[model samples]
Target: MSAQRPPLPPFTEETARQKVQLAEDAWNTRDPQRVALAYTEDSEWRNRDVFLRGRDEIVAFLTDKWRRELGYRLRKELWAWTGDRIAVRFEYEYHDTAGRWFRAYGNENWEFDANGLMRKRYASINDLAITADERRVAR
Candidate 1:
């Protein structure tokens, strides 16, 4: 069963939701280059325990991550936001080199520029579950 995405506040909710959807859509594409385009040239971000500064670093980081994580699927939910900052919690499942599977849980704090481009991103994530039958590629 698919869970409905939670609704946002007023005008800001749509904005927040869109930003999240954009991120999820980018992940669904599984293309690091395309996902990097959503951020600013000097965007600041941190994923899992790694810190990434600027678009180039972000691209490099994502590229390396995708290379190691096979059958990677990610989902993000907007937690709360006021103004240009939004907090999101996410879950990701992937398989490693030995075909071992793992699930990760994480929270992200995002800051967007006036143009809706992400400028700052801070994420905190950890493993949650490992399964064998999971069929969803990315939802």
Candidate 2:
């Protein structure tokens, strides 16, 4: 059975920010199963250019991502929210196995079910190469 995530829909600014922080905290853990639990079982996602369906696919994608994005740290801020949907702007820093660092900036639009489980997510992202000395996120 899955966890019943709360603060469901029709959000106030405070609640929306809380939701965004919750998502950021989960992603920072980099635990695929834990992260996948936030989404619906049949969730749909458009992550950059990849399209994914369902929790199994979400888990696989996140597994591949965290594998390549070593030392990942993320920050997400709530931009807007109404009804069961939210918009977020975020930045994350990670290094490749070669130790080359990058800062990725992105915006995501998420739609949730009544139970607060995200059913759809669309993200647009851009990555900039940065020197270790330029890194902003703590390891």
Best by TM-score: 2
- What is candidate 1's lDDT per residue for 1-139, written digit by digit as tens? 2222233223287778787877887887788888887787889988867888888998888888889888888888989988778999988888889888888788999877666677799989887556667535453
**Over 4 Å off, model 1:** 1-11, 134-139
Off by over 4 Å in 2: 1-3
Query: How many clashes (backbone atoms < 3 Å, residues ≥3 apart in a chain or on different chains) does model 2 have?
Result: 0
Tens-digit lDDT track of model 2 for 1-139: 5556887887788878888999999999999999999999999999999999999999999999999999999999899999899999999999999999999999999999888899999999999999999988766
* Model 1 root-mean-square deviation: 6.8
Q: After superposition, how far is residue 132 of candidate 2 from its true place, in Å?
A: 0.6
TM-score for each prediction?
0.85, 0.96
State the displacement of the C-alpha of residue 109, model 1, in Å, after optimal TM-score superposition.
Answer: 0.3
Q: Least accurate stretch of 10 residues (summed lDDT) in model 1? A: 1-10
